[model samples]
Target: MDRITLKEQLEKYRTPYEEESAFIQDFIQLTEDPLAFNRERLAGHFTASSWIVNPDRTHTLLTLHKKLGRWLQLGGHADGNENLMEVALKEAEEESGLKNLRLVENSIFDLDKHIIPERPHVPEHFHYDVRFMIEADLTDKLVISNESVSLAWFTFDSVVDMIGYNPSILRMLEKTSKSEILL
Candidate 1:
């Protein structure tokens, strides 16, 4: 979709947490810029992510990010794609080497704007991330990709401890409760 059309039609969802709600507003504002959907916009750009869980929702898959050296959900730059849902699915499939993914809900599951540390030729910038919930089999084989140092699955409680109790990641864990997952 074209930038202007997308800017005028971005979907807004309810997030109880103040931080997430604020991020949604900022995400909407980001769309005002013509380059917001493209990775080439160095200032910042949209990224889509998937909070991948097992089919039974008993575990979550995380990748040890190569650059940040932290376990993170699967995702990548939108690359000018205005359909974030599709982008999230594509990133999940590429990063985890998992197939036959299913969306738990076809809506925004979480919103995050994190700083991307500076690299050789890329300066630090915010990633206005839109996340979605995805499901796959726990028994499926996973192939690590170039973007990660490692990849693995863990229970929700295990993830809570593994990430060193990070607030945002904690928020996602809290949001993905059993009741919500069952829906």
Candidate 2:
């Protein structure tokens, strides 16, 4: 996706929570910049994440992020990939080593705007994260990528109890738990 297409997608996205309206609008404005998808944009940049759940939605796959030292959904910098859905799929595959995972939906499952702490050479910045729901078999073999300290499948209740400490993660989990959840 190019700038126009990315902007269009952001414009079409609707968040159920009224408080998140600001994040949606900010993402739209960020897409106007030529460097919106580039990691080099220190102010902020686009990223894609996969909320990987089992076919029955009983469990989710989470990686103990090496950089953050916290269990997080699989995702990564967009680099120059304007198509976030492609980026989400690629990241999920690369990070989880899960093949033939199904995209539960083609549209956005969640949107989060958060700050990325500064690393040695990288300055702190915000990530206009676009999340997509994905499904994988529980019996599938998973290879832990170097990007994570470890990976595991957790029950939805456990995820809510563990990661729900973070408001953003809590929001996503709450959305997934609902039977009528939409993109």
Candidate topping TM-score: 2
Once model 1 is optimally superposed onto the true structure by TM-score, how far is the C-alpha of residue 148 displaced, in angstroms?
0.8
lDDT of 1 at 26: 78
lDDT of 1 by residue, 6-71 (tens): 444445477788887766767778988888888789989999899998876678999999989999
Q: Give the TM-score comparing model 2 with the true structure, all chains together.
A: 0.93
Error of 1 at 53 (Å): 0.8
Q: What local lDDT does model 1 show for residue 182?
A: 65
RMSD after CA superposition, every candidate: 2.2, 1.9
Name every residue pair that clashes in candidate 1.
Answer: none
Measured against the true structure, the TM-scores of the candidates, in listed sequence, are 0.91, 0.93
The residue pairs in collision within model 2 are none
Q: Each prediction's Cα lDDT score?
A: 0.84, 0.87
TM-score, prediction 1: 0.91
For model 2, give the 10-residue run with minimal summed lDDT.
Answer: 174-183
